[model samples]
Target: MTDQPTTASPAATSPAATPSPLAQLPGAVGAPTAEHYGDPVAEQRALAAGRALVDLSDRGVVTLTGPDRLRLLDSLTSQSLAGLAPGSSAETLLLDPNGRIEHAMHVVDDGETAWLIVEGAAAPAVAAWFDRMRFMMQVEVVDASAEWAVIGAMAPADAEPSIPAAAPNGHALVWRDPWAAVQSGGWQYAAEAAHPAADYPAVELIVERAFLAELAGLARAGGVRLAGSLAAQALRVAAWRPRFAAEVDEKSIPHETDWLRSAVHLAKGCYRGQETVAKVHNLGRPPRRLVMLHLDGSDAQLPPAGATVHAADADRAEVGRITSVARHHELGPIALAIVKRSLDVTVPLVVPVDGVDIAAAQEVIVPPEAGQSAAVPRIPRLGAKSR
Candidate 1:
C-alpha cells in the first residue's frame, strides 16, 4: 500500500494533451462541469466504441491478504472462493444471516491476495464488517478505497490499440463482473504520489471540461438524449440487475435475490449464513418475487417509485409495488415491481398515481419457480373516460 497526497487535480486541459481517452471524464459527481453528456444512448455508444471512458473512481477498493485471505473471504461472502486462481475475478455477495445482501462486490484474486471492489456508498460498512469478523483469522484488510482510481471502458469485439498491459507492481486482472474485461494496476502521479490505477490504461485522455460538454453536445446533435436517474434505474431493473438496498432488503435471502448463480457457491462447505441459506433452499419458499412491469393506459404520465399495485379483478388487494420507473422514448413507460408470487398473473394490476390509473402488467423475468412457469402479464387499460 502506498501513501500519497490526497488532493485531486483539476479536470484535464485538452484532449490532445493526454495519453488516455479515459482521462477526459469527471472522477467525481457534481465536479465542475464545462460540458455535460446529455443522453444515455450516446454515452453507451461511446463506451461500446471505446471512444468514451466512464469514471468509476468513486467506487471503493479493499485489499485482503495473509494465509487466511481466501478462507476468510469464503466464510464471509456467499461465493465459493476455495479454488480461485490468481488473476481471476468473481462476483460475490456479503449477506446477513437472514440472507439479505449487505454488499455486492467484484473480487479480484491474485493467488495469494484478493481485492474487493464495492459500490462507493458501501465501502465503510463493508470494511467494518470484515474487521468485526476477523476474530482469529490470519488476515489483514486495508481500506484502499482512496488510493485507487477505477475506470470502465466497453469496446466492440475489434477496436483500438488494445487494453494496455498490466503493471508489474501490485496489479491484477479481474474478470468477475459481466460488463468488461477489467484490469487493476498502479499509476504514479509524482515522485511522492503513487496510487493504484486498477489496471487503467497508460494513455491519458486530457480534455478541458468544455470539450467534454462539446462532445456531449455532438452526441445530442446526433440524436442521442440524456436519461434521468429514473431511466437508468429502469434499465438496470429491466436487465434483472439488483440494486443493493431496493431488491436486497434486510429480510432477503440470497436465493430470493436470485444471486446464487452469480454470487453464491453451491458446493462450498459453510459460512456464517450458510445454515439459513441451506434451510431456506430446502424448506422455505421465496417471499416476494422481482418482476418487470409494463404499464398501459395513457402514456403521458408514468408510475412513480413506491406506487402501490393492486389487483383490479381480485378482491382489490395489494399485490405489489413499483420499485423503479423510467420513461424511455422507444419503450414508453416501464417499471420494476416487487410483488407477491401468489398473485394471479391474469388479473390486472393498477398503479394509482395520485388517483389516476397507470395501467400495469406483470412480466416475470426471474420467476418464483426460477424459469419453470414463465409468463408475460399484459397491461390492461383504464376506462375510456380515464383514458
Candidate 2:
C-alpha cells in the first residue's frame, strides 16, 4: 500500500456523492443483521469486551497510489495527509466550494497505497470524481469496494488481524478512530468528562472480499463472537461519531457534526472550501449542530431515520430530525439528531412515530459555541503583530 487519493467531477462542482435512501435504511431478509447472532444485548456485551467481529461488507474501499498521492490529497481534503506516516490513520472531508460536506473518507496510509474507507452508496461517484481530478498527476485511484471488504473488530489498532493489508510499520492498515479526542490541529467542540468512544476501541481492517467470511468464521471458532452492522452502528452512535452515510444531509458541514475534532486540518493550506471552514471555525458557529436524543422507550418503538423532531408541549415546531437511530442493549432507544443551533438545548423534544409521541430529551453533542465566535475581538488575527 502507498499514500494517495473523490465525488464531483472536475467540472461538476457539487454533484451528489451518495445515492442512499433519504429515509431509514432497514435490514433485509428475516431479521435485522444484529439479531442474526442471537441477542443484540449479548452482541453489545461482546463488542464492549473486544470479542466481537462485525461484517461491514456494505462499506466502500478505494486505493490511491503514486509518489505524489499524499501531497495531492493534502491539497484536496480537510486533513493533512502530506506527512501521514505508514500505518497512521486520518479522516478527511471533501467539501463543495461552499463548504458543504460531499464526502468523508477514513484514510490509512501504507507505504505503497492509501486506502480510503467510504460509504458504499458513494463509491462509484467518488471514484469518478477522483479520476477527473487527476489532470496531470502521477496518481492512480481505483474503487476496490468489490474486490476488498471492511470488517470492524473490537480491538486495538496495533493488534494483528488475520490477512490484513500490510503496512511498513508492522501494523495493519487500520483506520484508528481519532474521535476519542482532539487530535493535532483539531478542536474539541463537545465538552465532556470523557468521550464515550474512549472506552470502546474499534479498528477497521481491509481485506480481500473472498476471505471475509472465512476470517469471521475463524474468529468465531477462536471464541470471538460475530456481530453485524446493527451492533457496529449502535456503538458508533454511542460514541457520537459522525458517519458520512448516516449523519450527512445535503447541507452538512464539518462543524455541524462536531467532526472538526478529527476531520479538519485547521492549519493546512488552501483547499476547496478552506475559506468557509476557516470562517466558520475562527469566527462563527454552524447554522445547525448535531445532538443526541435519549428517546422514550416505553412504547418500544424506534424512530426511523429522517423522522422530524419538534419542541415539546406548547408549540410543536420542527426543530431537528433524527439522522440515525438505534435500540441499544443498555441505552434502549437512542438516536442522533441534527437541529437548529438556536433551539434551546435544555428543552425536551418530541418525535412522532406511528401516531405516538416518542419523547426525546436533548443531549448536547455540538455546543452552541462549537466554532470560533465573532466576538473574540481581543484575540489577534493571523498576521497581526503584537506590540
TM per candidate comes to 0.67, 0.86
Please give the range of 10 consecutive residues that has the lowest summed lDDT in model 1: 183-192
lDDT of each candidate versus the true structure: 0.54, 0.76
lDDT per residue, candidate 2, 1-387, as tens digits?
211323323222111222112111233212212333556667677776777767665677888888878887898889988999987898899888889888999899887788899877677777767767867988899878767777777766556543455343455778777776788888778888787867667778877666655654565456445665677778888889889978998899999998888899788899888999999988887999999999999998998999999998798999989999987778888999999999988888999988999999888989887777446757689998889
**Prediction 2 TM-score vs. true:** 0.86
Per-residue accuracy of model 1 over 80-101 as CA lDDT, tens digit each: 7766777666777776666666
Q: What would you estimate as the lDDT of candidate 1?
A: 0.54
Off by over 4 Å in 1: 1-36, 45-51, 153-175, 178-235, 297-300, 327-332, 370-387
> How many clashes show up per model?
14, 5
Could you tell me the lDDT of residue 227 within candidate 1? 20
Best by TM-score: 2
Q: What is the C-alpha RMSD of each candidate to the true structure, in Å?
A: 14.1, 6.6
